[model samples]
Target chain A: MQFLSIFHEINGDLKVVEKELEKYVLTQEPELTLAAGHLLKAGGKRIRPAFALLAGKFYRYDFEKILPLAVALEIIHMASLVHDDVVDASMTRRGHPTVKAKWGNRVSLHAGDYLSAVALKLISQYQDKRVLKVLSRVTVEMCRGEIQQISASFDAEQNLRDYLYRIKRKTALLISASCELGAVVTEAPEKIVRALTRYGYHVGMAFQITDDILDMISDEKVLGKPIGGDLRQGIITLPVIYALKHSQEKEHLRELVTKQVKSEEEVQEIIRLIKDSGAIKYSFDMANIYLNKAKKELNRLPDVKTKKTFKKLTSFIGERSF
Target chain B: MQFLSIFHEINGDLKVVEKELEKYVLTQEPELTLAAGHLLKAGGKRIRPAFALLAGKFYRYDFEKILPLAVALEIIHMASLVHDDVVDASMTRRGHPTVKAKWGNRVSLHAGDYLSAVALKLISQYQDKRVLKVLSRVTVEMCRGEIQQISASFDAEQNLRDYLYRIKRKTALLISASCELGAVVTEAPEKIVRALTRYGYHVGMAFQITDDILDMISDEKVLGKPIGGDLRQGIITLPVIYALKHSQEKEHLRELVTKQVKSEEEVQEIIRLIKDSGAIKYSFDMANIYLNKAKKELNRLPDVKTKKTFKKLTSFIGERSF
Candidate 1:
């Protein structure tokens, strides 16, 4: 059950999205094409598009109408990753060189802006105001979340609520928007749209928590980057937050986490301590809560097949490694 | 007359836009507020908004309905400047510290992104799809123009077509969109909207040419920046393009222009060579052509007062020193 294969039924629609992305990003500047194309080539799960397609199934499911929105959602996701790499100056993502690593931060910054502009343009073709409103609000919140991440970095007093708001804006809202947008564009009933949106929010939260947990405990090879990458960047995720409050080595962990510099050995030590503090289990428990809530929303939908697929998707998110 | 006072009749409306900017950019992060506020304090002409307001006057003027659009256009302009400052690594603008100077490039980068997202969200409230289409198209062209500028920087082979298209995409299209969006929103006929768009396009071209000219010849205290700023950043502008073609010292100028690094003396010498070549006069001549064309577009409009104001605005664009 690979993530890409999970959307096997909608693979034809996903291919259209892939083609549209290439057509839009292809420009006169060869270097720009290369930089902008780097992330597009590094295939992701297409989770946002998949969610949109699935959510559309409960209603009319006009693939042609949904195509632009699907592509726009994916581009927005890609744009955020490019900007995130610029801020962290991360050279590699998912085992591929980032735009920043290849073309420098200046080009990476503009490429991200270009992709966002392209996404906005694509969405502009839609006749509905709700689609634009949903996407733009999500974009604004994501920016606030990014700024908050920068300011809150290395703050020893970082709390659960701060982390929750940041991750929700950064991840959940966009995912939620994808489902809401797909449903809206297909003329879904209001009740069904709200249910799908709630499903997306809970699933997105569960997905991000799983990602943070894996960053601490997963192998570097499996994670596609270094271990404790978030810790190295002073990103204070859930495990670190929980461990800070309850770990036996709480004082030592804080000292290591708050340090301006960390060697490979220090990162290894920090990861080890976080793993032993029961924070991993605690994070999973919280994720299970979200996953269950996500499935509960699927119960409100009409189609048995789509509902089953969503439940399976929720389970996969709760346990995904990469 | 000062640029601000040029729009004396619209001062109260501009006040609302200024207040709205403060409201939208004021986030939870104090650092973000400061970075986003830096350029607002620097206070360039609200040229784009003025163009929009005047364009709207040709038919029906609904200030309440048009307010969001006016603010969005201004925000788009400001966003581009913040991004431009980041790319140029500029320390000051209009005699005030840039966002990049006060808060690092990372913060400045996100602040630009925040502003763009806010602008897009503001436009989302519009019932008309044409507004989004025009603005988003302008945004994409600007990004392409920026990428082209990067690719063409410091190249000895740069030509007039490259220079014209770059300036048009970077400066003219947004201004054109400002006018077009205003007209479209206010229920203007297509022909009048096209005329206003042409007016904006020509005025914007003249405005950027004059700005480039001022960058070379104006006092640092008045220009609010050092001379040869564009050359130092490898941004080949209109005068440099003109001088590269016809200057007696063409070979020497090309040699200096294409160099990886330049001294202050070299910059001053390059400026002198360009000035001696009459390229400044040549650029102003071209600007005058655009100014005349811009005024011609106004003959199609109805209101005598607004048309006179637009003509006066065109002249101001052609001759402004700062």
Candidate 2:
């Protein structure tokens, strides 16, 4: 599998990128700085920055330009994660206590606001108005996606199209913007920018779909949280939708999710039922479809070291059990 | 009083501006929309928009250009208020339940994000790069201000200079930007823009200092919140700082504040001590210094209708108690 192969190369860039992220996400307040460091130390896939750097390689391959954008994307991602932890009331992230859990919700929220402002300020140094414009708009879209999710939780009437749109905003826009913005700031041609954008969009879609599948089927050690947490929160992912279509137990599961559970056993039963219904496999198959499409989009770009890594990412998403 | 004389004109503009705020702030989510409506309906002086409009009148008084900038300023103000409420864990604002109080912290935080995004998007439509740059920087500065306040809270050793810097960010940047941006978009003369910016800066400093005094001395009916709320939260305002400089009674009050009171009566006693110590008058005197400075800045501009209103605003701050 290209997954391990590509991961090795992506790791080579990690130290350099990680240094830039630490430098930029910092604050003047020592407490906040430490809080931010604690959060950043929590391991992430660094997916946005990887894509940003790969896309930049297609143009001038300048780390000077790419590093800031990379750092900015990661900062933006980190900021959103901070707020998301608050919204979800999540205690542990990546097997460690989340910022909100450790410090408190107020500090977590302020830290997120701090990171976001710092991201905008860092990008403003680019003097590239387009980067600011895109970053600002993507930020707004991500927030709108959160609002949509909050408003539409557990509505069985919600369809796949709505789910797709939500993920597009919540997950894909920043990734796509990262790729496109990387190209734009490097003064890449319009066609190259479009190709990179399409590649990011499909890859982002596949990435999120795999995430949904993992939430349903992966081990807690791998996922770093309880399986079916999304379901417990009344977030109906693709697997649940698929399971509902086939199971005679659908009505009971729906009822459990729609109302607050009185006991842990009830939640366990719902998770067990969803797994037995083959919904996890169905969602994985759907994700594979997007992965194939994402790979196809990458074929239009020239063969390069980064493109090889981008190719490997498609397979990584498809094969990722965690 | 000029406030009485200008009341009708200001009220007319505020009514229109408040309606615009409602149109934008109201998410389709019924609960959130209701909470926003309550905050909007609980009315205050719409100073940001007024400054924008008055500044725009210096060159071209077209509401078409000015109104958007005005609304953008107000949106930024409202967004900051939402975030501020989250930071403070505030339960009441403007004599009503805050968004956080009614809808929870997550909803309020997301609502603030939405409002900020809306403001930036609206400002992007102006097609003036300089205006966009200035507005974006101000938004970042405003965030910096919030970070400063969050850092300063409960830090008994915070200096007056740091406090001044914090308030300039927390409160003054938006008001100053409102005036400067309004002028820039209208293509006003350089001198006019500079005058409006300085005027707005001084006026904003005065406004925040007055707010600090009112938090100690104003009644709940007038303040729209419990008196001594800042003290309860361990925020050392100008009045508290001034009082801390004098009197053994001030030491006792400071001790009470540091001890964390459990009863409203304890809070009341502290408030009485601050009032009896002449701290409120001392803060008012400091505010007058800023007001006089604001008036001096306005003198640089030739006598015009807008400049006259600007002068009136300086006086209005000195006499807002009426």
Candidate 3:
């Protein structure tokens, strides 16, 4: 809700994006339309699109020009979530049943593929080769990050470097591109584009770190899923990697995690151990580090209302609770 | 082996595409590299890239300009096959274990996704907006076709119209785009682009119909897959659709097919019934109809060596045994 206030000036543009997104999700087939519409209906913060809009605001803003890029970015994010649910075997996302949960993995796979292709189709209208190239590169990196995450699942030996690199590709690059593409499409100066891209990269890192922290400490009621959901799926996030390196109960935690956590009781016990291990504070501290770096990048841009809003967004990411 | 002779003139360009494809499949992660490499090394006919090359040859051929598009087309085709195996629960392709069979479905899904992204990234190097637009549209249609195929699977009520529509999206569109993109990249005359696209479309339809016939009739060793594979997987193709419409044993065949074919004997019995119903000949006749249409399109182009090669390729599709 706080993120909504950041969009007060651009609320009209956001509405147009929402309408365009709804229109894009409508497919000829009833089942596909339903599957794609499911996620579009279960909304999020629309952070990526908002970021794209804000970046455009730094220049002469035109909603029509920015609309397609913003919609495409959000669709790409949504497609990744669909596929992520399949890969994670997640039953729920954002307090709602995932595509995989309602229609089996096969349908989910094709749905995800469809959404991704739709994103490309929408952006193709822009005719900016740079935007297409950046988007294509980001897509490849995001998939590589996912593939790496899967291969590294439950490996307690993974270091901070690996964790940082994974999150950078999985979460940061797309967000970075969102900012860069917005500025590039709006014909902003190269320096401004670079600054905005750096800001997005840092903010994205903090955002994902907070998400990882929430998976460990947030309640099922608040988070829409069980705590340690990632652990149950064998996904070792930043906190878990930190806990593995520094926890006093490293041996017991390793034993519980190296093997699958089958029981709910076992999952809760592991959650408790991770919380007691000081990993949460370490993750928050790490997130703040990135947030501060994001603010520094924002300072490089000229003083404007949009600049303040961008700074507010970084802080918002740092403090977001579910 | 017969297809190799068809590539005799463009052999050097095809080699470049092969190398480009190999380069694109290489990744930093050992497991991903291996999974993707496995499929790339398994070897396809490279028919999509060959089509692109031959189309370009009709105009002023520039191997450099055509190489990226050709490689991208083949990668797209390869990506679909990887995902298709997972969707079909197939164990082998061309007598080689599939990515899903070698690695689990999760890994195969990511690998397929990665390859698709790579294809997009490869084409991004070419600064042609039309190329990007056409490729994106084709990718969306291809995914839609796959989704429709899944939803229609095991449904006995689907008609020939549905079957033709699905294959046009699944097989024909990308192949059609390959030809169109080839001509477009070369800045060929608009009339030539239209002719090549028509030729590709007709050729693609015939190619898939031939594939369907092979699934029902070819030897496992020769086809590199079990006979009646489409039926076993509950995929009703043109031949099956024809038999369902006209066979004297329609009632019994419908009963056996509507239920799962749980036994090898049942599969064999259904195969025999469909064969005796003359569906194979009807399917071949249908394929020839499209083949003739394709040759008609080629005739619109000027008399050139490449035009003759294109005609020969269509004939090869009509007569290819494996």
Candidate 4:
């Protein structure tokens, strides 16, 4: 096998899996087909499915077994995005108009349901009962996360522990399940499956922490949406929470939250305060901590090029726009 | 062995199932828990799940095997109700405030997601692959039916064939699957499974037809809601369709629909016209047809007391006023 570097050749298995996703997402609704198409075309990184395929390589990688899990995970992710658009009242996703903006909330909601139903249907193809149980539990956890987030909006004192738990349920659990179930479906060793699950949990925590930080600092052009949209909506994310704790301007920040800020200028001003208060850097440090932990989990795996690539991914997450 | 009069004996089993339902409807959020509880406490007849358990007894009465499927079907039914309240923008369900009205549309949507997730999770417990496949497909069809109904709303010329298909997806498919899968989980023979499936389909169709007829003639005091709610929302049910086909005052009815009548007086007038035009009787006749069909399917079942109660249920559907 080639060494894990940018110089290494990409696996043909991933290419086939990607091709299957493109085909699968195409065959959804006909009336809302275009809206479902819009969601698929919105350009997710497909990171979860990638983790699934990589984990699959450790086992007897049967395309039939691995592909359904990958597709199901991706579809679950897509459904969440559709509902996220509704929750955020977001007009665009990944630089394109969202289903809600294009077709209205009703259509978007139904499209999301259709996507979820399709995922559940696809997962039934697997004979492994444990895999189905994992998927079912993940879906429940994800919904509970969404519910928690909805109810917790604007609660400045919600604490880091609750925030972490929410994100773990919302983002990390599904991603962790992605890796673990990928191994289980492919019949990987129990040790490797457990290790990959740990890796996924930490990596996903890092990924979300980075995303939260990026929301406060990234360029709008690169982010494909306005920066600090989360803060504007009174979502007290990690960076905001950190800033609130340490800043001299805590009263002013709370005041701004109570009285909704309307303009992009005000939003940017808040973002500046958050960044200047060292909240973004603090968040970055926390993300790196998780990345380091994720890297350590891979030590349980054998000395292989794929393991190295997994390490590279951890590093990439840590260094991403630091 | 008791002959076919065993439907009422299911009350104890239903009470046991309802207690479990209360346990499952619990939530971390008090407001949502209470709102969902309102629907749960509205005291529905629990016909779908009861049918599943009763059918299960025909082979081997293992409530343990049947309980999950029964609860799952009811949860799915409740999820549909939550979403339907949002789509209809209604404020009440079964004489209590709906989740949408109490918690707003966002929470209502998420709560529906939570309910559906619970249903799917319970379903995943069964080791039988066939059961999983049937339940998942039924969910997909249910979502599709909702989409079709949303799109077809207020289309006065919408085909009767389309209407029947919509009811099949929205109501009958899950009910039929509950019976069929209940048998499958118990390892019941193919012929009994087929017969139970048919029984569920016919009963479900009759149920919807009764709902349509009751919309025209039942009192709000008895029905626990305003009569003509469907017509008020511009849902052209079987009675309305029949009235439009045969009534000389069809143009007047269309004008009333366009007027968007809201007052109880206007609702009563529409109800009177529907009743006077023989549309109510026509709808009742249609319900009787399905009731007879359901009875015919029951004839294939073994001669037992539970089966007799099943027959009584068909007659009950035909004769029940509200």
Please write out the lDDT profile of model 4 over residues A10-31, one tens digit for every residue. 3465566567667756654564
Residue A285, candidate 3: alpha-carbon lDDT: 97
* Best-to-worst lDDT order: 1, 3, 4, 2
* Per-residue lDDT of candidate 3, residues A201-260 (tens digit): 998999999999999888778787677788876778887887787889899888877665
Please report, in order, the local distance difference test score of every candidate based on alpha carbons: 0.83, 0.74, 0.83, 0.76
What is every candidate's alpha-carbon RMSD to the true fold? 3.0, 3.8, 3.1, 4.2
Model 2 DockQ class: acceptable
User: Predictions ranked by TM-score, top down?
Assistant: 1, 3, 4, 2
- Give the DockQ (2 decimals) of all models: 0.54, 0.38, 0.52, 0.43
Name the candidate, 2 or 3, with the larger DockQ value: 3
Pairs with backbone N, CA or C atoms under 3 Å apart (clashes), candidate 1 = none
- Give the clash total for candidate 2: 0
Could you tell me the lDDT of residue A111 within candidate 1?
A: 81
Candidate 1 lDDT, B1-322, residue by residue in tens: 4777678767788788788877776767786777767788877778788778878888888888788999899898888877765632222332343434322666778888999999999999988889888888888889889878887888879898999999999998998888888898898999999999898999888988898899899999888888888887788999999999999999999999887568889999999999999999999999999899988988887764778778778888887888
* Over 4 Å off, model 1: A87-103, B87-103
Candidate 4 lDDT:
0.76
Better of 2 and 4 by DockQ: 4
Candidate 2 chain A: worst-modelled 10 consecutive residues by lDDT: A88-97
TM-score, candidate number 1: 0.95
